[model samples]
Target: MDVEILARIQFAFTIAFHYIYPPLSIGLGLIMVFMEGMYIKTGNKQYEILTRFWLKIFAITFGIGVATGIIMEFEFGTNWAVYSRYVGDIFGSALAAEGLFAFGLESAFLGILLFGWNRVSPKVHFISTIGVFLGSMFSAVWIVVANSWQQTPAGYHIVGEGFNARAEVTDFWAMVFNPSSVDRIIHVWQGAFLAGAFLVLSVHAYYLLKERYVEISKKAFKIALGIATVISLTQLLSGHSSAEVVAENQPAKLAAMEGHYEESGSADLYLFGWVNDETQEVTGLKIPGGLSFMIDQDFEAPVTGLNAFPKEDRPGQVNAVFQFYHIMISIGMFLIGLTLYASYLWWKGRLFEKKWLLKIFAFSVLLPQIANQVGWFAAEMGRQPWIVYGHLRTNEGFSQEVSSNQILFSLILFLVVYAILFLLFIYSVNKKIKHGPYDEAKNPDEFLKYVS
Candidate 1:
C-alpha cells in the first residue's frame, strides 16, 4: 500500500522472476564444458550431440538472464537511489570487474561456442566452451563478493554525515574476499550445479521414457547423475560452513533463522516449525541441542538467540526467515536422497527400467530451482532492516523522489512483459526438445543410428 513496501515487493518479484534463468545458465554452462570436454577426450559422437543440444538451452537461458538482469540495475536508481548512492563506490568497481573479466570473456567466446563448430578446430572450440564456463563463474564471483560485503561490511568506511553519507572502499581485495564470500560463493555455485544437472537429467529421462535417443540419453543421464551426487555431498559441507560464518558474523540473523527467541545454553534445530512473533514462541518439531551441535560440534555449547539482541537490532521478518530456511533445507535433504537413490538404481542396471523413478526424475527438475529461490529468500529476509548489515537500515535506503503510484505502474508492466517472455522461453525450449538432437544434413546416419 505504501511506497516503501510496494517498492520492495516490486523489486522482490522482478528479481525472483529474473533469478530463475541465471543459475540455470551458470549450471548449464558448466555442464556444457564437461560434456564437450568429454567429447574431445573420448571421441564419442553422443557426447558431441549432447553438448550441442544443451548448448541451445544454455544460450536461450543466458540471453534471458542478461535481459532480465539489466532491469535490476535500472531499479537501483529509480527506486532505491539512496541505497545505490551509499554503496555505489563499492558496487561500481565490482560491477566494472564483472563487465571486464566475466562478461567480456563469456560474450567474446560464446559466438564461437555456438556457431564455430564447423568453422574452428575441435580443440579451439573446446577451449571456447571452457572459457564460457569460467566466465559465467567469474561473473557470479564478483556479484557475490559485492553482496557478501553488504552482509559483512568489510573494507569500507562511511565518508559523510546523515543523508550524504556513503561507503568508500579502503581495500578492494579485502572487499572482494570479505569474510563470507568464499563460503557463500561455493554454496551458491553448488546449488547452480544442482539446477543444471537436474535439467539434464529431466530431459534425458523424458527421452528414455519416449524410447527416443536412447544411447545419448543414457550417456547424458549418467554424466548428470555423477555430478549431482558429488555436488549434493559438497553442498552439505558448504551449508554447514556458511552457517558457522553466519553465526559468527550475523548472530541476530542466525537467531531468526532458527526461531530461537530466548538466550540459552543450547539451541534446538527445528525439523518443522512456525514462529509466532506475537507470542515470541516457536512451536514445531525440533531436535534438542541440534543447533548447538551444528554450530559448535557440541550439544551444550551456547548459540545466540533473538532475545540476546535488542529489539531494534533483530530481523523484522523472523517467521519468514525460519520458514524459508527450513523448507530449503528440507528440499536439499530430499534432493540428496533422490540423487543417491538414482545412483543406486543406475549401479544396479535398473535405472532405465524403472518407470516410477523416471517419472519422479522428470518432475524433480523443478525442485532444485525451488530450493535455490527459497534459500535466497532466507538469506535476504534474514538480513531484514539492515540493507548493509550494521551500517544501513533498509527503511533509509528508498529514493525520496519515488512515489507509490509510479512503482505500482512499473510493477504491473514488468509482470506483463515477464509473463510473455516466460511463455516464449518455454515454447522455444520445448520445440527444440521435441525436435531432438539429430541433424540429418550434418550426420547422415543420425536417424538410422538413434531413431531406428
Candidate 2:
C-alpha cells in the first residue's frame, strides 16, 4: 500500500471514531437548556430531576468530545502538516473564533451549571444553562464555517510560495458564509436536536416500561419529542437545499453519490443500485428526469456525471457513495414519518400507553443517530479524491515525516483508551439513572441518601 494512502485511511478511521461524541454534546446541550427552562417555569421537581440525569450523560459526552477533538486538531499539525500549512490562514481564523468565543464560554458556564446546583440561586443557574447552550451552538457555527469553506472554497487568494497551497482571506464574511454554510448548518443543528430528542424519548420509553421515573421521563420526553417533530420535518428542506448546492459546486461528488458514471441529460435518480465500473451504469429503479430536477431545480436541466471529469479525477467507489446516500435518505425519511406518527399519538394521549408504539419508538431512536452518522459519512467520503474540491487532492496533504507504523501504533492505543472511556460513561450514566437524581427527594431522608 502507498504509505500516504494508508495514512489517510488511518486518519479517517480514527477521526470518524472521534466524531461520535460532538453531536451528542451539541444535541444534549440544547436538551439541558430546555430542561432547565422547564424547571424554572414550572418549579417541577421532575424537570430538575431529568436535567441532572441528562447532564450526567452530557458530561460524559462533552468530555469525550473535548478529548477526541483535540486529537483531530493535533493530527492536522502532525500527520497532515502539509494540509494544515495549506489552509492555515483560513482554518486559523475559524479555530481561533471557536476557542475565543465558544470554548471559553462553554467551559466557564458549564462549571456553574454543574457545580452551582445548590451554591447559586435558581435564576443564576438557569442563566448559566442558557450561556452554555449558546456556547455549544456557537461552537458548531465556527466548526461549520471552517468545513464549509473547504467545501465551497471562498474568500481566499493563493500565495503560491511552496508545494502546499497557501490560502489567505479575501473577504471574511464570504469565508463565514461560503456557499453551503447556511443549509449545512441548519441540517447540522436539526441533526443534533434529533439526537437529543430521541435520546430523551428512548430513555422515557424505557422508564415507562420499567415503571421507573415515569413522571420525570415523561415531561422530558414531551419537550424533546415536540421539538424533534418540528426539526425532523424541516430538516428535509435543509437536506434538499444542501444537495442542490453540492450538485452545482461539486458535480463529481454528486455524480458519485448517485452512481452517475456517464454524462447524460434528463438523468434519473437511482433509489437503489450497484454500479458496474466497466459498463459505467447503475442497475436500479430510477425515476425519469428526477436527477435533473434535483441538481438544477429544473426537470429538463442537464445533470453532469462522472464522465464530465477526466477518468483519473473521478471519485472512486461510486457504489459505496450511492449506497451510503441511499441509507442516509431512507433513515431520514423514517425519522420524519416516525416523528409525525408520534405527534399524532401524543395528541391522542396514547404515545406512552401503546405497547406496540413504545417498542417501535425505542428501536427507532437508534436510527436518527445512525442516520446522522451515515449522512455525514456520505458527505465527507463522497468528496474524496479532493480534500478541498478543485483546490487540493487528498494525496497531496500527507506529511512525509509521519510513518505508517507510528500512526498504526497510535490508532491502536486510541481504541483501547476510547473503549475504557465508553465503558465508564455508560456505567456512570446507568448508575445515575438507576439511583435517580439527587434532588428527587422532598423530605430529609430522600435528600440525604442520594446527595453525596
- Scored by TM-score, the top model is 1
- Over 343-419, each residue of candidate 2 has an lDDT whose tens digit, in order, gives 89899988787877767766666777787777877887778777887888888888878888887787778779878
Which residue pairs in candidate 2 have backbone atoms (N, alpha carbon, C) closer than 3 angstroms, thus clashing? none
Segments of candidate 1 deviating more than 4 angstroms: 439-441
Best by lDDT: 1
TM-score of each: 0.98, 0.94
For candidate 2, report its TM-score. 0.94
Clashing residue pairs for model 1: none
Candidate 2 residue 191 Cα shift, in angstroms, is 1.0
Quote the positional error of residue 33 for candidate 1 in Å.
1.4
All-Cα superposition RMSD per candidate? 1.2, 2.7
